[model samples]
Target: MEKVNYKGADLLAHRFEIRVIRHFNNAIEYNAVPFILTEIQKRSDDFFQFPLSNGLLGTTIVDSAVTVTINKNIAYEPRRYFTCAHELCHVLLDTEYIRSHPGIDTEDKNGLPSSKNSSRERRANHFAALVLLPDTILNALMMEKKSKSYIRHQQKVSYETLKYRISDFIQLRFLLSRSMALDIASAFADKDADPLQQKGIYGFWHAAEDENISPLSRQQIAQKNNDLALGLIDPMVFEGCK
Candidate 1:
């Protein structure tokens, strides 16, 4: 099968994330991380997780309802959140892709971005990264800190694996020089962004702290989900989704 345009898949993921933010909650000060689970639950009722003694991080099933199964034994805290987000990518963005290729489980050995990734796997990874760090919040932080180093210090992020990921995000968001992104990567010691920060920074839809999670006022979550779903049905563009 031809590889899907990764840029398109990533953009589609971003669109979905924006809907998640707009639909669930839009307050600036409130945390938006819990919405990951909230959005998952909103999409499907039965969500499940278990410890994979094996090295595998997570998996998702799309039978009557989507169910996310995660590795409970992982050492890193951020890894679990990353795994869940990755599986959600498969659920939200790759539903048709999985349907066409049944039983081909989406597995990851640590969920690191790899040069050897298959097309769908690459898309899912990118989707997870973006959902974990929405550009709007990132932009606000970056603009406020004035230096990526300052943001790193304030957030206490120090993941070696994430240096490259942050570089990718900088490249995607600011369209800055690769050298600048590389410069930003060196400030951190050896850690990823805080998943706790993600929870406090992001939020549950309609969580008490969020002033913006009102239901059915004007923003349309269902409509946006329906629209994004059509684009994802056939992610490989030349095969004719357009």
Candidate 2:
């Protein structure tokens, strides 16, 4: 699998955060559906939703007018919200790729593309996480000693997403290894048994692994994540590559 353009994803998510606040009268909470619909309207695009089966989460179609279709069968409101944001990321960020590819960009049950090699899918997932739970908001919550349940309930994101976001923050902010970060995040998220071992959380964290994949070292991962967090890297470096 190709490397995900984390800097580019961060920049796009930050811009969307600004737009959400501006468009919604300084609203910080991103109501994914309404914001997505408003963005589609601004771009003169079309949107649809249907109760799809077979593990389909959403699809982005790029044609005369870009259309986003989401699965209404996602019974969990948080999962539905995440699916909407994930599809919207494709519409807004992957326009050129979608146009060139000329087919459906479908998300699986996990709200990610079934193809593991797709860096676009990974980037979109990261973008969805960042846009929904921005760094500043998460930082403030952490500073206030807010419990993971409180934060998760207030943000309306899944435990899996919350764990990943918290781990990402811990890794970047504290320059810690992935394992260390996950350990800390697990403590914050669930004081009982290890929640990281749970089905979705485990798979989501390691789904990109392959025998041929050379995992980045802790130092490298920390530097990259911190560079993006601290605005030390230019997002344009990833402009045409991703």
Candidate 3:
């Protein structure tokens, strides 16, 4: 996945990203239904769960008080949980948009970015993914050598989400060597242990070539990796989340 440019909604999501993670004690995954319920209750907001059309996931209505409604028809627990988180993003971050729109913001089955969705929908999706799978926790998992299957099961996220999240970080954010990135991504993705090795000599030569990463950046990455291994880095700290 290519790097998404930061937008107004992205900035708003970032503000609460660490807070949401800390609220869950940096757990890889938890029951988002209860978490979101607690959040809405804390704000004196209303929450409802009802059977809805299969194509609809959830909706957030901002009127006298914010009300979030989820479709009980969502069979997959993970998807249901994710929908709750996505709606929570709107309750917390879309105040201005809600005021202007003055109606219910409906979320369809396709919660992620799409031509049919609005920017606010995309922002909500971004917030849910960021809070659920933070960079710090993901890095810690990598340092602990956790497998992709384990992460997917533990994090309650789909394989596609895990792959894209790790790929985006390794390829764009961390700027790791191509072979190394493939190794890390594949390890998490539960693919071949070493996909590059299957390609033989060219793969070996490509892996050998320097990526020309700056010495300072390399040193910083090394330090952070070490800290993650040692469990010294605080996951609560924002550290300019990418």
- Backbone collision count in every prediction? 15, 0, 1
Worst 10 residues of 1 by lDDT: 200-209
Candidate 3 vs. true structure, TM-score: 0.63
lDDT string, candidate 3, 191-212, tens digits: 5433232222122222222254
Which runs in model 2 stand beyond 4 Å of their true positions? 1-4, 21-34, 190-242
**Model 3 ranges with Cα > 4 A deviation:** 1-34, 102-104, 112-117, 176-242
TM-score of every model versus the real structure: 0.59, 0.70, 0.63
For model 1, the superposed segments whose C-alpha errors exceed 4 Å read 16-30, 63-65, 112-117, 146-165, 172-180, 188-242
Query: What is candidate 1's local distance difference test score?
Result: 0.51
lDDT at position 21, candidate 1: 62
lDDT of 3: 0.57
RMSD of each: 15.5, 12.4, 10.0
Which tens-of-lDDT digit does each residue in 145-184 have in candidate 2?
A: 4556666666667777877898897676557578767764
Return model 2's CA RMSD, one decimal. Answer: 12.4
Clashing pairs in 2: none
lDDT minimum window of 10 residues, candidate 3: 201-210
Best by lDDT: 2
CA lDDT, every model vs. true structure: 0.51, 0.64, 0.57
